[model samples]
Target chain A: MDRSKLHSVIALDMVEFEFNGTPHKSPPQTTVAGLLESLGIEYRFCAVEVNEEILPKAQYSIYEVKPGDRIEVVTLVGGG
Target chain B: MSTNIHRLSVAGKLLESRVIVGTGKYETLDVMRESLDASGTSCVTVAVRREKLYDRDGKNLLDYIDLKRYTLLPNTAGCFNAKDAVRVARMGREILSDLGNPGADWVKLEVLGDTKTLLPDPVATLEACQRLVEDGFKVLCYTSDCPIMAVRLKSAGAASVMPAASPIGSGQGILNPNNLKIILEYLKSDDPDYPVIIDAGVGTASDVAEVFELGADGVLLNTAIAHARDPIMMASAVRNSAIAGRQAYLAGRIPKRLYAMASSPEEGVITSRPW
Candidate 1:
């Protein structure tokens, strides 16, 4: 979502970052848990990477994602 | 003979069924699940993709097939290079851990040659297999009916070496049986139990039967079942065909002859023939 145009950075305290190779913005949903929730990503279905390091599931809610962090998420899908 | 239940063993692990279905091309998740049930498979193949930002509502694929009930053979389906495949395999393993199922660390490695043929690139596949195996992942590599590559993969500690019967999703069915046969014969001879699975190009029940007869340890297919007019029925047929072929292989067929020999006793048939 293009939330960048919605408000100034200081107003909503939102952070913009790269997710799955695309630009994504959230309300500073700082931690991996909050970022995943804000992205509506099923926590159990995927592996998350913040800034090139694989963030363990146990620390998803603890490891904070910040601006300029390149996050990658992946999951298994239906295909041959 | 006792029905002791023949098992298809791959890298010391015994499979419950000879047919492995893929979780793709099904009209619905229910159809896919039902077809897997009908096929009597204990495992299913899946593709790994980047997660998207959306509140998925409908039943996910995981909802249809429980991970504990089935072995999820995740594949690096769209990967064209070793780097991508390695990255995908790492992510797949991490996903497994994230799901609290760290034991299910199997990945079906496939590095494609092109979009049209959908054949595996030998260089990339072997490289990926070696890397993944070293990284402690059970690699079931998907390659063409290239016997040398199969051996290399087995040497690289791949859990199983899967060679395509034909092009992916082509439904052509064993386009080159000789190559596949050579693969089965070669791999099994090395360890007397090395699993050589055939994936792709299975069009019908007879294809499954023929490949099994050729000594394929197992079959992995998706388009053949999911695209069938009756996916459930096709799944049933494939299950029976696999068993039948396995039995035929075990029972041993008569050797080929130049001409047919009379089955009836010659003395009993001679007098009547003259009259």
Candidate 2:
């Protein structure tokens, strides 16, 4: 396996929000918040889940991102 | 003197009006508030999500709704299982309690089995309803248009069973009227204590009227009124239509007939016939 070409595909509710721009490609070693920040995106009003485990808002900075991880980010709009 | 018409009551609150509105889809908060007031809804259902708590500074969606005006019925709209539904219901209770609105005990339980149709999973829905009811929460379950399922929900201690008229947000308008009517009849005859609230699949005022006329205790809707060109006007129209339907149902409707009946007297009146 080519270590440099390896990338982690972060899926957001079945839609892949690919993060492949990192030079240090050894599992990326980035927090979920950091990954979103690197992508120039902010968590407006959404909840994040990694590997079917709900990520608390306070712990987004501590949790690490991994390859083959299915992340779900649900944004609340409006409905009844 | 004629006896006063009976209205649906949940947890000791008498819901004189059978139209439950949703506080979503309006262009502005003011419009939503105006439409709710104009619609004369005694109860309004709202969806609860974790993200809704994170607002700018102190602004929140709950702040827009007036607690004194209508009874709040928080729903687990996005939950897909019993565990998630229970979690959402607890969060809703916490938020309501913190807001000094302790009476928001009613929950519109929804457990979607599939995302495409937003259909309720009957097994999960019943399981969650049982838990919520045991936890001292009034459960208004969103279920399928299946009479047996509805009976099971009612038997499992649901405050009310809300069967969809069609798929959620489809605007198909009572795709299974026979089933809904059967559910209504079954509840009225078998239990006669449970309230049957027709939820979802309503497109306009006429749709609302049809549900009410079918003997449903109430109608819960959102898109039909909120997404209308003139939401306030449409809200009022729907409100009136619901009231009309309820009154008509109470007044009793004549049975449907495939053949027309002769109105004129047969003995006194003579008519030309082409034999």
Those runs of model 2 whose alpha carbons end farther than 4 Å from true positions after fitting are: A1-78, B1-6, B51-58, B98-103, B270-275
Q: Chain B alone: TM-score in each candidate?
A: 0.93, 0.91
Q: Write the per-residue lDDT of candidate 1 for residues B1-275, one digit (tens) a residue.
A: 12444567765566788888899989988899899999999888877777755566635577787777677878899999998898887787787764554235888899998999989999988888988888888889898998888888888898989999989999999988888877887888757677788988999999998888888878999999999999999999999999998888777778899999988867755454445
lDDT of each: 0.83, 0.76
Task: Give the top-scoring candidate (DockQ).
Answer: 1
| lDDT per residue as tens, model 2, B146-254 | 9999989888888888999998878889998999989988888956656788999899999988987888888999988889999999999998898888888778899
Q: Taking the candidates one at a time, how many backbone clashes does each contain?
A: 0, 0
Q: What TM-score do all the candidates reach, one by one?
A: 0.91, 0.75
Query: Model 2 - which docking category?
Result: incorrect
**Per-model DockQ against the true two-chain complex:** 0.66, 0.15
